[model samples]
Every structure is written in structure tokens, then in C-alpha cells.
Target: MRPMLLATASVAVLTLVALSAPVRAADAPFNRISTFNVVENLPAGADPAKPTAAEIITYTEDGNTLIYSDSPGERIGFIDITDPAAPKAAGVVALDGEPTTTVVIGSKAYVGVNTSVSKDKPSGHLAVVDLATRKVEDKIDLGGQPDSIIKSPDGSYLAIAIENERDEEVNDGALPQLPAGNLTTFEVKDGRVVDASKKVIDLTGLAAIAPEDPEPEYVDINSRNEVVVTLQENNHIVVVDLPTGKILSHFSAGTVDLDKIDTKKDGVIDLSGSMKAVPREPDTVQWIDDNRFVIANEGDWKGGTRGFSIFDKTGKLLFESGTAPEHMAVRLGHYPEKRNKKGIEMEGAEVATFGDDRLIFVASERGSLVFVYRDKGPGAAPEFLQVLPGGVGPEGLMALPKRDLFVTAAETDNRKDGGIGSVVTVYQRQPGATAAYPTLLSVDGPDGLPIWWSALSGFAADAKDAGKLYAVTDSAYAQARILTIDATATPAKITAATVVTRDGEPAKGLDLEGIAVRPEGGFWVASEGNPEKKEKPTQNLLLRVGADGAIAEEIALPEAVAAQAGRFGFEGVAVVGTGADETVWIAVQREWKDDPKGFTKLLAYKPADKSWGVVRYPLDKAAKGWVGLSEVSPYKDGLIVIERDNQIGNDAVIKKLAYVSLKDVKPAPLGSEVTPPVLVKSEVKDLLPLLKATHGYVLDKVESFAIDAAGNAFIVTDNDGVDGTSGETQFMSLGKMN
Candidate 1:
């Protein structure tokens, strides 16, 4: 047996686990302060339903405003961050073409507008707009499509990557398709471009993979007026001197061998896989100093190393992050199991200095997080700082050290799926402040790997332990398992995991949604089922699970009653009394075919007599979407139930805890045709305020609630296992319920 770790199982997991300890004055951490929805900045007459995104972001010299490119909206959006804690929509500047990237110089914003007629005939221009006037000042044609643009530290030069990007549909997106790309540069004086100084440094015939087509992806400039470019598809890096417009050095980004990673997208987080010599097709590049730079290995084409790497100006490999960041995401429950081929998919990078400390921030496009690290200078190891949660598909990272702030642009909007939309998330660093997010985490198992867990749908407190609880994962993963949680820890640590097994193997086709501890040292769990599922229909079931996690018995609804069940079946399970009076109760999520409009079922089964009964539970009216019961637990003299709407973010409502008295009320027979008596309920707590206090978004599933032996009440939200979600689990204590 492995010793339980109060913090993390391994040193590498400290990136996220370190938040479990107290923070010192010097180690003051960054915590998210606010989120600004991009839709709020849409133009006056534009359709509000149209999707918008904050792809690439930059700030003015005063750091009081943010400018981001909204490619889908074909515009540039602004945000007022004068009060970093409360970001407001300043407005948006409509453009003729899609904006790819934007950079601010003095009081003007320079944007790379892609007006490509076709992949074979790439065309774009640099649009310069006066920030104060909000008018386009000038547009310089570059004769190609621009992907990334940047300004020199000395404010004397601007560099752009003319990426004549290839169409993936064209010959399977193979190289040498057509015209090649080049490095475009211009001299700047007093915030205006010197057009006569325009120089195009051909980047063709350089990469070993495709000498004829070099698709320059990202570019960054250092203080010395030197630009670093990453040819992503070609798997190469190039260094160019701005003043001379000369290509000084270039090198292959190369390949890396990865181990202990999840390689399949089979609805499981198995990290025992390996990849041999995979391409490090890098994306964004940033300079830590004049001597070294870093690249996010996004692996857009064929390979992704699953991390970032550092290189010297001469193309010498300085450091490779390997799988440390991926492991950190796993511990934080941010791992994207559906897109496991590239893991977290590092796609954005930023470097800045705050006070006396230099920091490096890398964005995970798929994981929806930004990884922070302290740069220990060149040739030394960078210390992993902490990870920050973003909205969804965080693509751009910017650090405002002067204001002690960091901002991320999440480009993926999920409103069509009833999820969160694209937004700019802001975080602030304060002295002696601890990390406020990641209220839950998983520790290392006996195998020395962080136990992967998410979609926490049900919870049950220990019979005697004050701070110990048990939780169950739902259909988010293929395998159903019960996890042990130490609520005493600052971020409630998941200490151990036990697979819910049947016949000596992991249980299959189980969506365990609710759990309750039994009086005789076992557990009663409810598995929600959907008969409408065409692939493999499932039936709602009640399982008697021993302490060892093996199923001892399974109970199903009678055929006559089960025939009336809908897709939303059993959601929560609870046990009451003992011996002959032991009654197992299950909460049905929504109205079945035979139920009344606003009423679902609360099933009761007596193990002594093998009899079943049912009572009706009235559901509150939803402001929008549908309202349903998510959980039920024994409380005081009645039951505490979690009722919520299926809406997310600002549209969410009805996430509340309600109590119902079961004193003297008798249930009708399981298959009775008569209307069952309804249970009277009263609102105990409005959980919306607690969910909003997290500063991310109002998650829809407030699925678990339980009270410990010491009278402490806890609530946890299910993240749906990072599938089409931000992968954020909010585990909080409601204190003692009155």
C-alpha cells in the first residue's frame, strides 16, 4: 500500500498541487478576477446569435485596455481593464476582412487582416487603426496572408510571418502544394511604418521536409531587433536579424519520444501509452531574454510532443518540457481525453517580468488552461509556478506585469451546445494571496501516476469520519469508479480510487450517478440510464456495492413500471433506517412518461420484504431550458435535494438546495395508477451565489451534496470529464446546514 500524500504524489505534480499549502509573501499567486464575454462587445446591429471569439489579444501602452481579434466576427474587440477585477466591453472595430492578430504600438493598433481569395492565391494587408479615434489609419499590402505579427522591444521594428497557409483538403494537406512563404519586415519611427523600408526575406528552400513550401506560423521579436519564426507545418524554426533583413540561422524543430501518456480517444484516461520519435511541430514562439526563446509544440500536422521547448539564438536546444505539463493537467482534471493524441495541445506562449521575477506562461488549447512558470534565466531549469483555468480553448496569453495582471483569450465558443462562450479571462497577482481555483484535485496512486478522475456526479460522507467523503464518476468515462476524498485539505484531495467491478473486472455500461453509505458498511449506488440511446441502451439500476467496490446485488424496476421510464431515469440514491426497516431511496431526475408535468419520482425499496413504493417530487419552473433534480441526501428529518437548470454561464438559474419532509407520508405502490402524494419542500440554500463566486462561469451541474458526521455540508459540480466543457470542478463547503 502506498502512503497517502497530503499534497501531491510526485514532485512534478507540484505545478497544481502546490496550492494545497500556505502561500508566503514572496510566493503570492495569481487568481482569476473576472471574465468578459465577447458577445458583449458585438457591434450595435450585428446578430447577437452569431458566434464570436477572442483569438489573439494585446494591450495598449497604458495597460488600461485590451484589443483582441475576432476572426469569425471579422472585427477587433476592445475591453476596458482599468479595473482589472471588473472588465467591461469597450466596443468593437469592424473590418473588411478577418483579423488574425493584433499588436499595439503607442496609441495605434496594428492588425493582420486575412483577405485570402483562395489558398492558391493568398492575399492580406496590415491595417493600422488609431486607438484614440477608433479609425483605420492605413493599410499596407504584403502580397500574402499574415499569420503572426510583432514589434521589437526598442519600438523600432515590426515583423510579420507571411504564412501562405495550405488547405488541409488539398492533397491531404501535404507540403510543396504551391507558392512559399517569407518573412516580412518594416522599420518603424514614431509609431508609423516606413513603407520604403519593406523587405521580404524568402523562407523557402530551408526546411528539410518541404523546401518549396515553408508555412511560417508564429513570429516574435527580441530587444535586439531579432525575429524568431516557427514554420509549423515544416517542423522548423528560423532566426532573422531585423536591421539587416537577413536570415542568420535556421534549424529543424526535431522529434521527441514520449512515455506514460494517454494515446487513445476511447473514453478513458489510460496513461500507460508511449510514442516513439514524434514531431515537435511548434506553434507560438516567445523570447525569455535576448539569448533564448521558447516554442509551444502544438503539432498541428502529424505530431505533437505534448509540451514546450526552449532554444538558443543559434538554434541550440536548451530545454524540453516533455510530459510534465501534461501530467500537471491530469492532476488538475483539465486533461482532454477526447483529443488525447496531442494531449493538452500546447498552442500559446508568453514571457514577461513582474517586479524582479521573470515568468513564462504557456496556453493549453485543448485543456482550456494556462501553465505558469518562473524563468530561472538561460541554461537553468524553469520552476513550475501554477496553472490557471480559462474559459475554453485558451489560445492567446498576455501578461501585464506593470498592473500585476495576466489575461487569456479563449477562442472556442460553446453557446450552440448550451455551454460557455468565448471570453477574455483576467487574473491578478497579489502579495500573500493563494490560488483560488482548482478546489478539487487527484493525488498519485500506488502506480505513482495521478489517479485520473472527473465528472463527480454523486457524493456520500463517511459514517464516522468528519472530513472524509466518497464520490462517483458518471458516463464521462467508460469505467465507473468510486473515489475517496479528503475534504480537510485546502483543495479537497482525491486520495484513492476503486473501480466499480463486476465478476472481478471493471464494470461496463454503468453511469453511476448517485451514492449513499449503508449502515452495515456497504454502499447503495444508483446508475442513471437512457433507453433512447441507440448504440447500447441502458436501464436504471440500484447496486449493492461492498466496501471493496464489488457489486453484491443489482435491483431493477419492475417491468410494468420500467416501461414508463424516459431517458432521464434514476439520478440519486440514499439509504435510511436499519434491519427490517432499511429502505433504499432513489431520486428520478425528470418526469417519466407516466409522471405529471412538474413531478418526478422518489422510489423507495425495502430490502426485508423486496417491496417497492414511489412518491412524487415537484420541480421548480426553469427560467429557461429544463429544470431537474440532480441529487438527494438524508438531512435532519427529511431529505436535501439539489435541483438545477440545464443552462450554463449567465443563463443558469435554479441551482438550489431544497428540503422535503418524509415524516408520516406513505408512498403508493410502484406500479399504482393513482396519483402519488407530493412531498412539501422548502428552499434551504441558493447555490447560485456560491457557484458565481468562483469567477469562471456558472456551471450547470450541481450534482453532489452531502453532510458529514460533524455537521459540515459539502457541494460539488460535475465537469462532464472535460468533454465539450471547460473542465473545471467546483468543490465547496456549505458549512453546517441549519
Candidate 2:
């Protein structure tokens, strides 16, 4: 295992400077700008007072247009910016179910539609549309409400994020309602639907260590083929294996107990005989390599202390940067001249690396700055470089070989125009300088507004070629676009890109989450449906895009077997292929239902015939009731799905090593269990309760899960921490399931 790097005196100096800068206003000028707004408002009869559900916004690789959707509108919109200065409304597509999210591959776009418009229904669907034609080519009926959609790097599998809240209400009668969600896997072949499976590994055991309060939030797969998930509310990281969908390990990233903290001192307080720690919110996770990951430790949902924590691929305890890891400076004292109050000191690193001599980058989201550092050794303090300021909200950071550059999506309320988000900023390393600040370049959108608000998520570069860069944004539009950057370009502008629009119409009702590039010039994007609109849910859609910004093809999802009576969707995407051709893998999350035997779905797709297939594995039996599938990625010869068991009163478990063959895959037996061996069991544990009592019962629930390359899985809890009793927070793991 690699050693953790500590902060040095130089870091202290930088921290002081970071604490002195003022917060940038939302309307600050950027190099290049673009924006998109939901052109259409809520329907005439819709509730005007309700907050517009549309949140995420994203772009395609060709960078020509933008795609987004919204829950309140229950529709998807497309904006064509073949001209960055002026963007035109391409078109908007309506769906039978409430559309939540979308992902575009080639010519096909997959959308996660929520059919359960009310708490009584709680189901959804996945809509497959042809981008070139702008028509709903196919629709998969997912039994439960879905969350997010993802594809495997090989192009053989599809993963869905499923929520099964109804099961918890039914099984644990009269108990406090636990948010039920899991990860599902599906099989696809040549744009057709195929086999599907679900794994809901038990997590009842972890309850002893950390309380279950919030449900899972985000899930992903790392290079090592492991699944990692973030339990937002609970502040724990769950790790699982891919093939078997088993819980390999679990660890707490950070713990906080507001009740025990002295409001006057901002520190934990000791009770007569017990110690109380404040709860922290673990928002995001990024893999540095196959065996290492960096976690964004948002101290508390109330916006208290914030920092970053580093962990090995196995979820082991590593090093953590102090509070407020971003590069923004906080005011030291009250200023009489400005009549302003003093601000808290900012410290810690936002993101860090562990390869080729450790390094860390502290990104100040509000300040639009970054602080660089060189790690001396494991647990040894890192040496600070200099304070570098540029684009806004440098949330996502990517380090290229020899040369390191970070991408900033200048996402802010001011950058948004008529609901459309704008451009991405590129900060390149300056040549012949070790401490000089990187040069900033703007990757503009069609309307010249910053193409980012809260939508941008991940960034990837071709391993063989350093000149190519790909970034993804989550949008309400049916499709998520990829921004392809030419690293060789002097100013680093996006030259070309593809979007998730069809027949000049945008795929409405889809929430796109993550994207990955394939070796064959084709890339994949993940779509997650909206849980709030579950009555008429949508199926998970996987799209494939060729090198020239053209849609190559798309795969339609099949109905989930565990979905019994509701709808389903997907969240994350990953692909793994050999030779000239590759197989695509997708993760599916089944919607929550009232049934006790509910399960999630996972599927695979092949590009050869554009047909769909399923993994003939018995994952449902392993989960033993309703299971929520979160994420899936390529591992060994098969793929892995993060199976989160959401059954009430049961501890969540990480299921691993559930393997399936790529050849001769078929669709799942809807509402039936056929294949048996695919169901593999992993470490099971009860999740710690967020509060000792929520009214009368404890709060515990699993939300999202993901795995890294070395089989390390991270689980994110969804404990809101609103209650005072629950103190369990973040968790992680670095060991394999026995």
C-alpha cells in the first residue's frame, strides 16, 4: 500500500493566504462563457410554488450543443449551439412518464423516466430514443423507481441505480421509513434489450459501527473494477466486488455529532461517560489509481468544517486534510472600514494524487483557485507550491502525465441564462516553470454561457494520447454531452462534440451522471432517473458515440425482473473490450416498490448487432428480498455491480464476485428467477444509525455504492442528520470480503 502524505509548513503558509482572499461574486467575468435554461416552464396545471425539479446540465463530446431536462416540467429540452455565440432551441421531447435523466452514446440516447408520479405508484421506465430521428425507439419497463444509469467500458453491460423504499415500509411495519435503493445490472446486444439481474447484499452489520440515516447518493466503478459508493447522510463509504455484487469492506471517512459539540468552540464534547462526534457529509469520490481514491469530506450538511480525506483502494484509513480544503482565503478579522464580519480560516486539499511522487491540489470552489503541493512520504506533510487562481468552481481535477492540468466548469447561478448552463475552463501547466500558475483557457458552449452549474462531474483523457480530453455533466435533458478538448491546442478550446438530441428535439426527463471514453473512439454516458417522478418510470438507456462526434448506435433496455409492478432506471457507465470490437456494460437501479421480494437489475449490450442481452446470474436470491443496485464496472473477464440491500431493519452488505459470461446472453425472466450461479454473497453488516431516535425509531438506510480497480468498494449513506440522536457518519473499507 502507498503511504499517506502529510501537510508541511509551506502548506500552513498557503493556508494563511487562502484564508485572506474574499469570496468571488457570482457574476464575475470569465474568459469564455455559455449558458442554457429550461426554455419551457412548468405546465399550466403544474404546481407553480414547487421548486423546479430540473437541476443537472451537461454537453456532448463534439461540443456543438447542450442537453438537459427537469422534474417539474416533466420534459427534456435540447439547445443547438453549432454557433457558440448564439444557441437555438433544437427541440423538446415529452414522455409518458416523468423524464429524469439522459445519456447519449452514438445515434441512440437512453433516458431514465420515472413513472411513479406519486408515493403510491413508485415505479418508472427507461426510454430509448434515436438521436438522429428524435423518436422513442423503445421503452424498458423497470419494476421499481430508478436513480442513475451507467455503461461498462467494454460496452457489454448496463447498470441501473434502483430504489426500493416501499419494501422497507412493508417489511418493517410501523417502523420509521427507511429510504430503499440498490444497484441493478442489465445486458444489451446491438441496441436491443437482453438479460438483467439484481443484488441487494445485506448491510445490517455496519449498523453497529455507523447508524443508517441518509440513503446512498452517488456510485461509481474504478480502474480496478471495484464498486465505490457514497452514503451522503451517513457519511460512510461502502466498497463491493463487481462479479458477485458482494460487500467487500466498509469504513467511516469522518464522523461528527453536532449535539455533543460545544457551539462556542466548534469541537466535540465529552458526555458524562461517552464522547460525541459531529457528523460529516461525504459528497464525492475520485480514484487516483486502481488502489487509491480521494474523497470530498464536507464536514456537515449544515456547512460547518469541510476537507478532503485520502484512502487506499481497500477503504483503509489514510490521511485527511484539515477543514475547508479549498484554495479560497477566509477573512481573519472584522473590518471596520468595510463594515464586514470576519470569515473562518480555510485549510485542507480538495483533491490529491498518489502516483509518481505524491501530489495534492487544493481547489477552492467559491474562490476559483487551487494550491499545489508535493508529498514527501506516507503520512509526511506535503510541501506547498504556490497559490493559483483561475476559473470558477474548480471541482473536477485531472492530472495528465508529465503535464498536469485541471478543468473548471465555471458553474454558478450568475453563469446560468434562461436555465441553460455555460462553458468549461481549462487550466494548463505552464512550460519551463515548476511553481508558475497554469494558463487558463475557456471551452465555450453554444450560448457563450458557462456550460456548468451543478452538472459537471467527471473528466477522462485517452491513455495512449495526451492531446485528447473528455468531460461529462449531469443534465435534465435526456442526453449528457461530452466535451472533447485538444490538449495540443495553444488556447485549449473544444473544437468538436456530439450531443443527446434527436430530430432537433432534446430527450427530456433524463438525468445524466458519468461518462467514459473507449479505446475505439467511442464513448459512453450514464443516465439516472428522478425518484420524485416514479409513477411512470423510464428504462435505462446507453449511447455510443464515434470519434467524429456522430452517433454510432444505441441499446434499448429491457424491463427489470425485480421491478414487479413499478419502473426502473440507471446511473453509472463503464466499458471494457479487447481486439477490434468491445462489449458495453451498464448498471441499472430498480425503483422502490411495496413488494417484499423486490430486486434490482443489471444488463449487458453488444454493438455487433445493436441487440440487448442479460447476465444469466441469480443475484436476487443472494440479496434475499428487495435490493437496490447502484453501480457496475469491468472486472477480470466479467463485470461488477454495487448491490445495496435496502430492506428495512436489515444491515446493508457489499456483494462481490458475481460473474457472468459475455457470450450468449439473454433477457431476464421478467418477474421470475431463472439463472442461479450468478448470485454470490459477500460481507454483510448492519449500518450504524444516523440518530439514536427519529421520533421513536433509528434512522438507517443505504443509498449508493461503487468499486475501484483493486476491488475496493465505497458506499455513501443518505443520513440527513436532521435528527439529533444519530451520530454515525462516513465509512470506507480497504479489505476484501471473507
Best by TM-score: 1
lDDT of each: 0.88, 0.44
lDDT of 1 by residue, 82-136 (tens): 9988889999888879999998888889999999989999999999999989999
**Residue runs of model 1 more than 4 Å from their true location after superposition:** 1-26
What TM-score does each of the candidates earn? Answer: 0.96, 0.41
Model 2 misplaced stretches (Cα beyond 4 Å): 1-54, 57-66, 77-91, 95-101, 114-121, 141-145, 163-176, 188-214, 256-276, 299-305, 326-738
lDDT of 2 by residue, 598-637 (tens): 3444555556655544442234443434455545555455
Per-prediction CA RMSD (Å) = 4.8, 29.4
Which candidate has the highest lDDT of all?
1
Candidate 2 local Cα displacement, residue 225, angstroms: 2.6
As a TM-score, model 2 comes out at 0.41
